[model samples]
Target: MSDRAAAFHALHRPGRPLLLPNAWDHASAAALAACGHSAIGTTSLGVAAASGKPDAAGATQDENRDLARRLRELPVLLTVDVEGGFSDDPAAVADYVAELAALGVVGVNLEDGRPDGSLAPTELAAAKIAAVKAAVPGLFVNARTDAWWLGVPEPRDEALRRARAYREAGADGLFVPGAPDDAVGLLAAQAGRPLNVLHRPGGPGLAELGRLGVARVSTGSLLFRAALGAALDVADAVRAGREADLPDVPAYGWVQELTERFRTDGHR
Candidate 1:
Protein backbone atom coordinates (compact mmCIF):
# COMPACT_ATOMS: atom_id res chain seq x y z
CA MET A 1 0.00 0.00 0.00
CA SER A 2 1.08 3.57 -0.59
CA ASP A 3 2.13 5.59 2.44
CA ARG A 4 -0.93 7.80 2.27
CA ALA A 5 -3.22 4.83 1.92
CA ALA A 6 -1.57 3.09 4.82
CA ALA A 7 -1.84 6.19 6.94
CA PHE A 8 -5.52 6.53 6.12
CA HIS A 9 -6.21 2.87 6.89
CA ALA A 10 -4.41 3.20 10.19
CA LEU A 11 -6.76 5.99 11.24
CA HIS A 12 -9.70 3.61 11.49
CA ARG A 13 -9.17 2.18 14.94
CA PRO A 14 -12.21 0.55 16.49
CA GLY A 15 -12.08 2.41 19.80
CA ARG A 16 -10.60 5.57 18.33
CA PRO A 17 -12.63 6.33 15.24
CA LEU A 18 -11.53 8.89 12.75
CA LEU A 19 -13.77 11.95 12.74
CA LEU A 20 -13.64 12.72 9.02
CA PRO A 21 -14.96 16.10 7.94
CA ASN A 22 -16.21 16.37 4.39
CA ALA A 23 -15.24 19.42 2.30
CA TRP A 24 -16.63 20.73 -0.99
CA ASP A 25 -13.90 22.87 -2.53
CA HIS A 26 -10.27 23.83 -2.33
CA ALA A 27 -10.83 26.61 0.19
CA SER A 28 -12.83 24.42 2.54
CA ALA A 29 -10.39 21.54 2.23
CA ALA A 30 -7.33 23.71 2.67
CA ALA A 31 -8.92 25.44 5.61
CA LEU A 32 -9.65 22.08 7.19
CA ALA A 33 -6.12 20.94 6.56
CA ALA A 34 -4.88 24.23 8.00
CA CYS A 35 -6.86 23.42 11.10
CA GLY A 36 -4.87 20.15 11.32
CA HIS A 37 -7.29 17.72 9.71
CA SER A 38 -5.06 14.91 8.45
CA ALA A 39 -7.72 13.67 6.07
CA ILE A 40 -10.62 15.29 4.19
CA GLY A 41 -13.41 13.98 1.98
CA THR A 42 -15.55 15.62 -0.72
CA THR A 43 -19.30 16.05 -0.34
CA SER A 44 -21.22 15.11 -3.48
CA LEU A 45 -24.20 17.30 -2.62
CA GLY A 46 -21.99 20.29 -1.96
CA VAL A 47 -20.08 19.80 -5.22
CA ALA A 48 -23.21 19.45 -7.31
CA ALA A 49 -25.08 22.28 -5.59
CA ALA A 50 -22.12 24.64 -5.91
CA SER A 51 -22.21 24.07 -9.69
CA GLY A 52 -26.03 24.30 -9.79
CA LYS A 53 -26.47 20.65 -10.65
CA PRO A 54 -28.35 17.90 -8.88
CA ASP A 55 -26.41 15.56 -6.66
CA ALA A 56 -26.41 11.73 -6.53
CA ALA A 57 -27.56 11.66 -10.15
CA GLY A 58 -24.05 11.33 -11.56
CA ALA A 59 -24.11 15.00 -12.58
CA THR A 60 -20.94 15.95 -10.75
CA GLN A 61 -18.33 13.56 -12.22
CA ASP A 62 -16.29 16.33 -13.77
CA GLU A 63 -16.83 18.60 -10.79
CA ASN A 64 -15.73 15.86 -8.42
CA ARG A 65 -12.65 15.10 -10.48
CA ASP A 66 -11.71 18.77 -10.60
CA LEU A 67 -12.07 19.13 -6.87
CA ALA A 68 -10.06 15.97 -6.27
CA ARG A 69 -7.28 17.31 -8.47
CA ARG A 70 -7.20 20.57 -6.55
CA LEU A 71 -7.27 18.86 -3.17
CA ARG A 72 -4.33 16.59 -4.06
CA GLU A 73 -2.07 19.59 -3.62
CA LEU A 74 -2.99 19.93 0.02
CA PRO A 75 -1.10 18.18 2.82
CA VAL A 76 -3.98 15.88 3.67
CA LEU A 77 -5.36 12.57 2.54
CA LEU A 78 -8.36 12.80 0.19
CA THR A 79 -11.33 10.52 -0.40
CA VAL A 80 -13.82 11.33 -3.17
CA ASP A 81 -17.45 10.30 -2.93
CA VAL A 82 -18.33 8.87 -6.35
CA GLU A 83 -22.06 8.42 -6.07
CA GLY A 84 -22.93 5.02 -7.50
CA GLY A 85 -19.46 5.05 -9.00
CA PHE A 86 -20.94 7.43 -11.64
CA SER A 87 -22.19 4.40 -13.60
CA ASP A 88 -23.82 1.02 -13.15
CA ASP A 89 -21.24 -0.95 -15.08
CA PRO A 90 -18.66 -2.41 -12.73
CA ALA A 91 -15.80 -1.91 -15.16
CA ALA A 92 -16.66 1.76 -15.57
CA VAL A 93 -16.80 2.23 -11.82
CA ALA A 94 -13.45 0.58 -11.40
CA ASP A 95 -11.93 2.77 -14.11
CA TYR A 96 -13.24 5.97 -12.53
CA VAL A 97 -11.80 5.02 -9.12
CA ALA A 98 -8.51 4.02 -10.71
CA GLU A 99 -8.27 7.53 -12.10
CA LEU A 100 -8.76 9.00 -8.65
CA ALA A 101 -6.12 6.69 -7.24
CA ALA A 102 -3.75 7.78 -9.98
CA LEU A 103 -4.34 11.35 -8.86
CA GLY A 104 -3.13 10.46 -5.32
CA VAL A 105 -6.51 9.94 -3.68
CA VAL A 106 -6.14 7.41 -0.90
CA GLY A 107 -9.77 6.40 -0.48
CA VAL A 108 -13.31 6.63 -1.90
CA ASN A 109 -16.91 6.19 -0.73
CA LEU A 110 -19.03 4.25 -3.22
CA GLU A 111 -22.69 4.06 -2.33
CA ASP A 112 -25.46 1.71 -3.44
CA GLY A 113 -28.15 4.39 -3.36
CA ARG A 114 -29.64 5.15 -6.76
CA PRO A 115 -30.94 8.51 -7.94
CA ASP A 116 -34.50 7.19 -7.75
CA GLY A 117 -34.09 6.53 -4.00
CA SER A 118 -33.92 2.78 -4.54
CA LEU A 119 -31.07 0.61 -3.44
CA ALA A 120 -28.93 -1.11 -6.03
CA PRO A 121 -28.93 -4.87 -6.16
CA THR A 122 -26.68 -6.29 -3.49
CA GLU A 123 -24.75 -8.32 -6.06
CA LEU A 124 -24.11 -5.26 -8.21
CA ALA A 125 -22.80 -3.30 -5.23
CA ALA A 126 -20.55 -6.18 -4.34
CA ALA A 127 -19.35 -6.38 -7.92
CA LYS A 128 -18.43 -2.69 -7.86
CA ILE A 129 -16.49 -3.14 -4.63
CA ALA A 130 -14.65 -6.17 -6.00
CA ALA A 131 -13.87 -4.41 -9.26
CA VAL A 132 -12.53 -1.35 -7.47
CA LYS A 133 -10.29 -3.42 -5.24
CA ALA A 134 -8.99 -5.44 -8.15
CA ALA A 135 -8.16 -2.22 -9.98
CA VAL A 136 -6.63 -0.40 -7.03
CA PRO A 137 -5.84 -2.73 -4.19
CA GLY A 138 -4.23 -0.06 -2.07
CA LEU A 139 -7.11 2.39 -2.24
CA PHE A 140 -9.47 2.20 0.73
CA VAL A 141 -12.99 1.36 -0.45
CA ASN A 142 -15.77 2.40 1.94
CA ALA A 143 -18.71 0.42 0.60
CA ARG A 144 -21.92 2.25 1.55
CA THR A 145 -25.37 0.67 1.66
CA ASP A 146 -28.40 2.95 1.59
CA ALA A 147 -30.81 0.58 3.26
CA TRP A 148 -31.28 2.86 6.23
CA TRP A 149 -30.89 6.04 4.23
CA LEU A 150 -33.62 4.92 1.83
CA GLY A 151 -35.91 3.86 4.68
CA VAL A 152 -36.30 0.42 3.27
CA PRO A 153 -38.34 -2.15 5.13
CA GLU A 154 -36.35 -4.01 7.77
CA PRO A 155 -33.30 -1.82 7.15
CA ARG A 156 -31.16 -3.48 9.78
CA ASP A 157 -31.52 -6.91 8.25
CA GLU A 158 -30.87 -5.57 4.76
CA ALA A 159 -27.90 -3.53 5.93
CA LEU A 160 -26.39 -6.55 7.63
CA ARG A 161 -26.84 -8.66 4.52
CA ARG A 162 -25.26 -6.04 2.29
CA ALA A 163 -22.47 -5.33 4.72
CA ARG A 164 -21.44 -8.97 4.83
CA ALA A 165 -21.66 -9.28 1.07
CA TYR A 166 -19.64 -6.12 0.55
CA ARG A 167 -16.93 -7.15 2.98
CA GLU A 168 -16.68 -10.56 1.37
CA ALA A 169 -16.27 -8.77 -1.94
CA GLY A 170 -13.20 -6.90 -0.66
CA ALA A 171 -14.64 -3.75 0.86
CA ASP A 172 -12.25 -2.20 3.33
CA GLY A 173 -15.04 -0.60 5.33
CA LEU A 174 -18.82 -0.65 5.64
CA PHE A 175 -20.75 2.64 5.69
CA VAL A 176 -24.40 2.50 6.67
CA PRO A 177 -25.50 6.10 6.98
CA GLY A 178 -28.53 7.06 9.04
CA ALA A 179 -28.06 3.95 11.13
CA PRO A 180 -29.87 4.16 14.45
CA ASP A 181 -27.69 4.60 17.50
CA ASP A 182 -28.90 1.45 19.23
CA ALA A 183 -28.20 -0.68 16.17
CA VAL A 184 -24.71 0.66 15.60
CA GLY A 185 -22.95 -1.82 17.87
CA LEU A 186 -24.80 -4.70 16.32
CA LEU A 187 -23.75 -3.67 12.82
CA ALA A 188 -20.20 -2.95 13.86
CA ALA A 189 -19.81 -6.30 15.55
CA GLN A 190 -21.25 -8.31 12.68
CA ALA A 191 -20.20 -6.33 9.61
CA GLY A 192 -16.75 -8.07 9.73
CA ARG A 193 -15.12 -4.74 8.77
CA PRO A 194 -14.81 -1.22 10.05
CA LEU A 195 -18.23 0.36 10.43
CA ASN A 196 -18.68 3.96 9.31
CA VAL A 197 -21.64 6.04 10.39
CA LEU A 198 -22.70 9.51 9.38
CA HIS A 199 -22.52 12.20 12.04
CA ARG A 200 -25.98 13.40 13.05
CA PRO A 201 -26.28 16.57 15.04
CA GLY A 202 -27.68 16.06 18.57
CA GLY A 203 -26.90 12.38 18.21
CA PRO A 204 -24.10 10.39 19.77
CA GLY A 205 -20.77 12.17 19.58
CA LEU A 206 -17.42 10.73 18.46
CA ALA A 207 -16.48 9.28 21.84
CA GLU A 208 -19.75 7.41 22.06
CA LEU A 209 -19.45 6.14 18.49
CA GLY A 210 -15.96 4.82 19.22
CA ARG A 211 -17.30 2.96 22.18
CA LEU A 212 -19.92 1.44 19.91
CA GLY A 213 -17.09 -0.11 17.82
CA VAL A 214 -17.33 2.38 14.95
CA ALA A 215 -14.02 2.86 13.21
CA ARG A 216 -14.92 5.93 11.19
CA VAL A 217 -17.45 8.71 11.60
CA SER A 218 -18.05 10.89 8.56
CA THR A 219 -19.78 14.27 8.51
CA GLY A 220 -21.05 13.55 5.00
CA SER A 221 -23.09 16.58 3.74
CA LEU A 222 -23.84 17.95 7.18
CA LEU A 223 -20.97 20.44 7.12
CA PHE A 224 -21.95 21.69 3.69
CA ARG A 225 -25.57 22.17 4.71
CA ALA A 226 -24.55 23.88 7.91
CA ALA A 227 -22.29 26.24 5.96
CA LEU A 228 -25.14 27.18 3.64
CA GLY A 229 -27.43 27.72 6.61
CA ALA A 230 -24.84 29.90 8.30
CA ALA A 231 -24.41 32.02 5.19
CA LEU A 232 -28.15 32.53 4.88
CA ASP A 233 -28.45 33.36 8.54
CA VAL A 234 -25.75 36.05 8.26
CA ALA A 235 -27.41 37.49 5.18
CA ASP A 236 -30.83 37.62 6.85
CA ALA A 237 -29.42 39.26 9.96
CA VAL A 238 -27.63 41.93 7.92
CA ARG A 239 -30.75 42.64 5.85
CA ALA A 240 -32.79 43.08 9.01
CA GLY A 241 -30.21 45.60 10.31
CA ARG A 242 -29.16 43.25 13.08
CA GLU A 243 -25.56 42.36 13.91
CA ALA A 244 -24.60 39.03 12.39
CA ASP A 245 -24.28 36.60 15.25
CA LEU A 246 -21.42 34.80 13.59
CA PRO A 247 -19.28 32.40 15.60
CA ASP A 248 -15.51 32.48 15.08
CA VAL A 249 -15.67 33.57 11.47
CA PRO A 250 -12.33 33.24 9.71
CA ALA A 251 -10.58 36.50 8.91
CA TYR A 252 -10.40 37.61 5.29
CA GLY A 253 -6.60 37.53 5.43
CA TRP A 254 -6.67 34.09 6.96
CA VAL A 255 -8.75 32.84 4.08
CA GLN A 256 -6.37 34.54 1.67
CA GLU A 257 -3.41 32.98 3.42
CA LEU A 258 -4.76 29.53 2.59
CA THR A 259 -4.49 30.30 -1.11
CA GLU A 260 -1.29 32.24 -0.70
CA ARG A 261 0.48 29.40 1.04
CA PHE A 262 -0.64 27.04 -1.67
CA ARG A 263 0.67 29.38 -4.35
CA THR A 264 4.03 29.93 -2.67
CA ASP A 265 4.76 26.52 -1.16
CA GLY A 266 2.56 24.45 -3.47
CA HIS A 267 1.04 22.92 -0.32
CA ARG A 268 0.52 23.51 3.40
Candidate 2:
Protein backbone atom coordinates (compact mmCIF):
# COMPACT_ATOMS: atom_id res chain seq x y z
CA MET A 1 0.00 0.00 0.00
CA SER A 2 1.09 3.55 -0.66
CA ASP A 3 2.26 5.18 2.56
CA ARG A 4 -0.24 7.92 1.94
CA ALA A 5 -2.98 5.50 1.03
CA ALA A 6 -2.06 3.25 3.94
CA ALA A 7 -2.00 6.25 6.24
CA PHE A 8 -5.52 7.14 5.20
CA HIS A 9 -6.70 3.56 5.50
CA ALA A 10 -5.20 3.19 8.96
CA LEU A 11 -7.40 6.03 10.11
CA HIS A 12 -10.36 3.76 9.44
CA ARG A 13 -10.60 2.00 12.76
CA PRO A 14 -12.91 -0.97 12.92
CA GLY A 15 -15.29 0.74 15.29
CA ARG A 16 -14.68 4.35 14.33
CA PRO A 17 -15.18 6.25 11.12
CA LEU A 18 -12.20 8.41 10.31
CA LEU A 19 -13.11 12.04 11.00
CA LEU A 20 -11.85 13.88 7.93
CA PRO A 21 -11.87 17.60 8.58
CA ASN A 22 -11.67 19.80 5.53
CA ALA A 23 -9.81 23.12 5.31
CA TRP A 24 -10.18 26.11 3.00
CA ASP A 25 -6.67 27.56 2.74
CA HIS A 26 -3.07 27.21 3.82
CA ALA A 27 -3.53 28.81 7.21
CA SER A 28 -6.64 26.81 7.97
CA ALA A 29 -4.95 23.58 6.87
CA ALA A 30 -1.72 24.37 8.69
CA ALA A 31 -3.62 25.19 11.86
CA LEU A 32 -5.59 21.96 11.63
CA ALA A 33 -2.39 20.04 10.93
CA ALA A 34 -0.81 21.58 14.00
CA CYS A 35 -3.72 20.19 15.99
CA GLY A 36 -2.45 16.70 15.06
CA HIS A 37 -4.91 15.86 12.29
CA SER A 38 -3.21 13.08 10.40
CA ALA A 39 -5.26 13.46 7.21
CA ILE A 40 -7.05 16.44 5.72
CA GLY A 41 -9.38 17.11 2.81
CA THR A 42 -10.57 20.24 1.00
CA THR A 43 -14.12 21.42 0.62
CA SER A 44 -15.07 22.63 -2.84
CA LEU A 45 -17.71 24.91 -1.36
CA GLY A 46 -15.15 26.71 0.82
CA VAL A 47 -12.65 26.90 -2.01
CA ALA A 48 -15.27 28.23 -4.44
CA ALA A 49 -16.62 30.74 -1.94
CA ALA A 50 -13.16 32.05 -1.01
CA SER A 51 -12.36 32.52 -4.70
CA GLY A 52 -15.74 34.19 -5.38
CA LYS A 53 -16.79 31.43 -7.74
CA PRO A 54 -19.76 29.10 -7.83
CA ASP A 55 -18.98 25.62 -6.56
CA ALA A 56 -19.48 22.43 -8.67
CA ALA A 57 -19.47 24.56 -11.83
CA GLY A 58 -16.00 23.67 -13.06
CA ALA A 59 -14.77 27.09 -11.97
CA THR A 60 -11.68 27.80 -9.85
CA GLN A 61 -9.70 25.00 -11.46
CA ASP A 62 -6.44 26.93 -11.27
CA GLU A 63 -7.24 28.16 -7.78
CA ASN A 64 -7.83 24.64 -6.54
CA ARG A 65 -4.63 23.47 -8.18
CA ASP A 66 -2.74 26.28 -6.49
CA LEU A 67 -4.22 25.35 -3.12
CA ALA A 68 -3.12 21.74 -3.62
CA ARG A 69 0.40 22.99 -4.31
CA ARG A 70 0.35 24.98 -1.09
CA LEU A 71 -0.91 21.96 0.86
CA ARG A 72 1.67 19.65 -0.70
CA GLU A 73 4.15 20.42 2.06
CA LEU A 74 1.78 19.65 4.89
CA PRO A 75 2.61 16.71 7.20
CA VAL A 76 -0.82 15.14 6.82
CA LEU A 77 -2.31 13.21 3.96
CA LEU A 78 -4.23 15.49 1.60
CA THR A 79 -7.41 14.92 -0.38
CA VAL A 80 -8.81 17.49 -2.81
CA ASP A 81 -12.36 17.91 -3.96
CA VAL A 82 -12.19 18.27 -7.72
CA GLU A 83 -15.77 19.07 -8.64
CA GLY A 84 -16.78 16.77 -11.46
CA GLY A 85 -13.13 16.63 -12.32
CA PHE A 86 -13.50 20.33 -13.33
CA SER A 87 -14.70 19.28 -16.78
CA ASP A 88 -16.86 16.71 -18.53
CA ASP A 89 -13.90 15.54 -20.55
CA PRO A 90 -12.41 12.41 -19.05
CA ALA A 91 -8.97 13.26 -20.40
CA ALA A 92 -9.13 16.64 -18.72
CA VAL A 93 -10.19 15.00 -15.48
CA ALA A 94 -7.32 12.56 -15.67
CA ASP A 95 -4.90 15.41 -16.30
CA TYR A 96 -6.20 17.26 -13.26
CA VAL A 97 -5.89 14.19 -11.02
CA ALA A 98 -2.37 13.65 -12.30
CA GLU A 99 -1.42 17.18 -11.36
CA LEU A 100 -2.74 16.72 -7.82
CA ALA A 101 -0.98 13.37 -7.41
CA ALA A 102 2.27 14.98 -8.49
CA LEU A 103 1.85 17.37 -5.56
CA GLY A 104 1.65 14.45 -3.08
CA VAL A 105 -2.12 14.49 -2.73
CA VAL A 106 -3.21 10.95 -1.92
CA GLY A 107 -6.89 11.33 -2.55
CA VAL A 108 -9.47 13.32 -4.52
CA ASN A 109 -13.24 13.76 -4.26
CA LEU A 110 -15.03 13.87 -7.62
CA GLU A 111 -18.75 14.45 -7.86
CA ASP A 112 -20.93 12.96 -10.58
CA GLY A 113 -23.83 15.37 -10.31
CA ARG A 114 -23.59 18.62 -12.22
CA PRO A 115 -24.34 22.14 -10.99
CA ASP A 116 -27.37 22.39 -13.26
CA GLY A 117 -29.14 19.82 -11.08
CA SER A 118 -28.48 17.09 -13.57
CA LEU A 119 -26.41 13.97 -13.09
CA ALA A 120 -23.53 13.25 -15.39
CA PRO A 121 -24.00 10.13 -17.50
CA THR A 122 -22.97 7.07 -15.55
CA GLU A 123 -20.75 5.82 -18.34
CA LEU A 124 -19.05 9.17 -18.69
CA ALA A 125 -18.44 9.46 -14.96
CA ALA A 126 -17.09 5.96 -14.77
CA ALA A 127 -14.81 6.76 -17.66
CA LYS A 128 -13.43 9.70 -15.74
CA ILE A 129 -12.82 7.47 -12.73
CA ALA A 130 -11.01 4.91 -14.82
CA ALA A 131 -8.91 7.55 -16.49
CA VAL A 132 -7.93 9.03 -13.14
CA LYS A 133 -6.85 5.59 -11.92
CA ALA A 134 -4.81 5.11 -15.04
CA ALA A 135 -3.19 8.51 -14.73
CA VAL A 136 -2.34 8.54 -11.04
CA PRO A 137 -2.77 4.86 -10.18
CA GLY A 138 -2.37 5.73 -6.51
CA LEU A 139 -4.60 8.77 -6.11
CA PHE A 140 -7.55 7.61 -4.04
CA VAL A 141 -10.68 8.56 -5.99
CA ASN A 142 -13.66 9.19 -3.69
CA ALA A 143 -16.55 9.08 -6.14
CA ARG A 144 -19.44 11.18 -4.81
CA THR A 145 -23.03 10.72 -5.90
CA ASP A 146 -25.54 13.54 -5.62
CA ALA A 147 -28.63 11.44 -6.19
CA TRP A 148 -30.18 12.54 -2.93
CA TRP A 149 -28.57 15.96 -2.69
CA LEU A 150 -29.91 16.74 -6.15
CA GLY A 151 -33.43 15.74 -5.06
CA VAL A 152 -33.68 12.52 -6.95
CA PRO A 153 -36.40 10.23 -5.69
CA GLU A 154 -35.54 6.67 -4.71
CA PRO A 155 -32.15 7.88 -3.54
CA ARG A 156 -31.11 4.62 -2.00
CA ASP A 157 -31.49 2.49 -5.09
CA GLU A 158 -30.02 5.13 -7.33
CA ALA A 159 -27.08 5.78 -5.05
CA LEU A 160 -26.32 2.08 -4.80
CA ARG A 161 -26.42 1.63 -8.54
CA ARG A 162 -24.10 4.53 -9.22
CA ALA A 163 -21.85 3.64 -6.32
CA ARG A 164 -21.39 0.10 -7.54
CA ALA A 165 -20.57 1.43 -11.00
CA TYR A 166 -17.97 3.81 -9.62
CA ARG A 167 -16.35 1.09 -7.55
CA GLU A 168 -16.13 -1.10 -10.62
CA ALA A 169 -14.67 1.83 -12.49
CA GLY A 170 -11.78 1.90 -10.02
CA ALA A 171 -12.84 4.45 -7.43
CA ASP A 172 -11.11 3.72 -4.14
CA GLY A 173 -14.09 4.85 -2.12
CA LEU A 174 -17.76 5.93 -2.43
CA PHE A 175 -19.20 9.17 -1.04
CA VAL A 176 -22.95 9.66 -0.82
CA PRO A 177 -23.10 13.11 0.71
CA GLY A 178 -26.85 13.36 1.21
CA ALA A 179 -27.82 9.76 1.55
CA PRO A 180 -30.71 8.92 3.86
CA ASP A 181 -29.92 8.12 7.45
CA ASP A 182 -31.60 4.74 7.15
CA ALA A 183 -29.75 3.99 3.98
CA VAL A 184 -26.34 5.38 4.92
CA GLY A 185 -25.36 2.38 7.01
CA LEU A 186 -26.80 0.03 4.46
CA LEU A 187 -24.79 1.70 1.73
CA ALA A 188 -21.62 1.26 3.72
CA ALA A 189 -22.36 -2.41 4.08
CA GLN A 190 -23.55 -3.04 0.53
CA ALA A 191 -20.96 -0.99 -1.26
CA GLY A 192 -18.27 -3.50 -0.21
CA ARG A 193 -15.92 -0.55 -0.63
CA PRO A 194 -15.04 2.14 1.85
CA LEU A 195 -17.93 4.54 2.48
CA ASN A 196 -16.92 8.21 2.79
CA VAL A 197 -19.86 10.25 4.06
CA LEU A 198 -20.63 13.85 4.91
CA HIS A 199 -21.31 14.48 8.59
CA ARG A 200 -24.39 16.53 9.45
CA PRO A 201 -24.36 18.14 12.86
CA GLY A 202 -27.65 16.62 13.97
CA GLY A 203 -27.29 13.41 12.06
CA PRO A 204 -25.97 10.06 13.21
CA GLY A 205 -22.91 10.61 15.36
CA LEU A 206 -19.54 9.17 14.38
CA ALA A 207 -19.94 6.31 16.82
CA GLU A 208 -23.18 5.35 15.13
CA LEU A 209 -21.48 5.54 11.76
CA GLY A 210 -18.63 3.37 12.93
CA ARG A 211 -21.12 0.84 14.21
CA LEU A 212 -22.62 0.98 10.75
CA GLY A 213 -19.17 0.29 9.29
CA VAL A 214 -18.58 3.67 7.66
CA ALA A 215 -14.89 3.83 6.87
CA ARG A 216 -14.58 7.58 6.65
CA VAL A 217 -16.63 10.54 7.88
CA SER A 218 -15.98 13.94 6.34
CA THR A 219 -16.96 17.34 7.73
CA GLY A 220 -17.67 18.53 4.26
CA SER A 221 -18.10 22.31 4.41
CA LEU A 222 -19.70 21.85 7.82
CA LEU A 223 -16.65 23.19 9.65
CA PHE A 224 -16.39 26.07 7.21
CA ARG A 225 -20.03 26.98 7.72
CA ALA A 226 -19.73 26.49 11.46
CA ALA A 227 -16.83 28.92 11.56
CA LEU A 228 -18.96 31.49 9.78
CA GLY A 229 -21.81 30.81 12.17
CA ALA A 230 -19.57 31.13 15.20
CA ALA A 231 -18.31 34.51 14.00
CA LEU A 232 -21.86 35.74 13.59
CA ASP A 233 -22.83 34.41 17.01
CA VAL A 234 -19.87 36.07 18.70
CA ALA A 235 -20.63 39.39 17.05
CA ASP A 236 -24.25 39.20 18.10
CA ALA A 237 -23.28 38.29 21.63
CA VAL A 238 -20.89 41.25 21.83
CA ARG A 239 -23.58 43.62 20.61
CA ALA A 240 -25.94 42.28 23.29
CA GLY A 241 -23.21 42.64 25.98
CA ARG A 242 -23.22 38.94 26.87
CA GLU A 243 -19.57 38.59 27.80
CA ALA A 244 -19.98 35.15 29.34
CA ASP A 245 -20.97 33.25 26.18
CA LEU A 246 -18.31 34.58 23.87
CA PRO A 247 -17.16 31.02 23.04
CA ASP A 248 -13.77 31.49 24.74
CA VAL A 249 -12.05 32.44 21.53
CA PRO A 250 -8.27 32.60 21.37
CA ALA A 251 -6.56 35.96 21.29
CA TYR A 252 -5.36 37.34 17.93
CA GLY A 253 -1.82 37.48 19.33
CA TRP A 254 -1.91 33.74 19.91
CA VAL A 255 -2.88 33.12 16.30
CA GLN A 256 -0.22 35.55 15.11
CA GLU A 257 2.43 33.88 17.22
CA LEU A 258 1.51 30.54 15.71
CA THR A 259 1.98 32.04 12.27
CA GLU A 260 5.48 33.14 13.22
CA ARG A 261 6.23 29.77 14.73
CA PHE A 262 5.04 28.05 11.60
CA ARG A 263 7.35 30.18 9.50
CA THR A 264 10.31 29.74 11.80
CA ASP A 265 9.99 25.98 12.08
CA GLY A 266 9.01 25.46 8.43
CA HIS A 267 6.82 22.58 9.56
CA ARG A 268 4.08 21.56 7.22
- Per-model TM-score on C-alpha atoms: 0.97, 0.92
Model-by-model lDDT, in order?
0.92, 0.86
**Cα lDDT tens digits for candidate 1, 27-142:** 88999999999999888999999999999998988898888877777899999999999989999999999999998999999999999999999999999999999999999999
What candidate 1 gets wrong by more than 4 Å, as runs, is 264-268
Clashes of each: 0, 1
Scored by lDDT, model 2 comes in at 0.86
| Span of 10 residues, lowest total lDDT, candidate 2 | 259-268
Error of 2 at 136 (Å): 0.7
Error of 2 at 205 (Å): 1.2
lDDT tens digits, residue span 17-63, model 2: 88999999887887888889989999999999989998888897998
Best by lDDT: 1
